[model samples]
Target: MKYYPQLTKRQAVSALEEFLAERAPALERFRQALRADGRDPDTLLDGTTQGLVPLWGWVLSGLTGPDAPACTDPATVPHEDWPSWERFTAETEAILSYESVQLLDGFISYLVRVVEDRTPTAQWQIGQHPNKRYQFRNHPVLAGADRQIFFPGPVASSAREVVRGRRAPANDEMAGYAQAVIEALSAEETRHEPPEPLVEVEDLGDHPIRGREIEVSLREDIAHEYSRQVDHMVKTLAMEDGITRVIREDREVLLVATPSWNTTQLQEWVTQALRDAGNDHS
Candidate 1:
């Protein structure tokens, strides 16, 4: 891990400029990794934007690991309380594929270090805004009986043909059809459309890039209006565009599945993640 010295408030403007100058390569890499193509982190601190969160804090947080004081016990016990930086990064692969739990824990731990050291949180931030590129895994095309059939996108005809087959009741009939539909939609295609953000992040000052974990847990009472709500939302977004999930009920069980989503338990979490990300910064 690269060590980044913290910038003090008392530092001269030249010092600040020099500080950024020294870190340009590292920060620019972060910008690419974050897809933060809009503004330089804190380079516009002069007046381009006021109280705009400096992105440096996020960078430090990314490089640092969880501090031991963050644990329930005050006494640190090496790996038990805190893992080494090498150990931390080795398992995490933070930039590419760190899981959500690792991110949350690491972030909170970094906060613990900041608070323990009496460091100002604002120093960590530089000027920058997020520009996330949402790439959903699969496109959805809803084909329901007695409902307005939605067949959109390049592979729409193929998926439509699969749905047109008899809704025969055999063992795993729904599962079979779901797989067929998935296969049909899996046809290779390219699109440049970006999904609209459901939750807006406006002038995130001294907070976070992801203001909150945008996740949706299906209401336990989905049998009520929630299922209808889900169906409606899915149908509305199922037209010829960059759709990545198709909603189909088991005719037998609409919102019933164990250990996974959909009747065949085929739908992946990306569908819900994409929806939640677009829905809110919540």
Candidate 2:
């Protein structure tokens, strides 16, 4: 699957500047109003900020609370846990997806830095006294696109359509339709995965950057730990004809699959190594 790349520090700074430019005029006007009343500029944006708990975090936790059955270890059971278990499972069955899990995790990391750098008093003041109220309610980016469609409960449009096509068979038919609807919605939920965080580092080597190869080196400590994990996973995979070599001169590790193996296999092996070392995201 194709992925989007993360912006570099310079790129991120540029994006931030653009973002501020769009919003700054109104914000500054509001700030002036606040300042007239002796409010701080820092306080203005602080109020507007979403703070430590990112919107994505709230959505994820609400969907799957720690105490929820899905979060609980299902192997160990107490009769009393069944109720919570069933509830959590039902919700999870409805909403669990690769994208959902990724978004929940990625946004938590993104929000931590955002919140730490923000000045709370400024954020509060900006939010309270903005020249125009910023209403993020129902914003598409804040919540996933499907948020409105399958809300409160899974959508039943397809099921309803199917029911209308046939002669409804009393309670049994309705129950079957309900089951079908649940399955369809669950499938749909997982169909849309969250966008992976993409990082585009400049390749310093030649050879056309073959099949997702990036010529880069990590910090010494991280590289050491990753080298160990990569070795371990490589053994577990038990595939011969592939060589894992640490190219100290290049300051990067290189995994080479002999020409006897197809490109697909080589890519998969390298991908697994990146994932195991948690450098896939890096």
Candidate with the greatest TM-score versus the true structure: 2
The TM-score of candidate 2 is 0.20
User: What lDDT tens digits, residue by residue, belong to model 1 across residues 196-260?
Assistant: 32222112112243221112223233324344555665455444243333433321122211222
List lDDT for all candidates, in order. Answer: 0.28, 0.33
TM-score, candidate number 1: 0.14
- What are the RMSDs of all candidates, in order? 25.2, 21.6
For model 2, what is the alpha-carbon lDDT of residue 38? 62
User: Cα deviation of 142 in candidate 1 (Å)?
Assistant: 56
TM-score of each: 0.14, 0.20
lDDT of 2: 0.33
Error of 2 at 131 (Å): 44
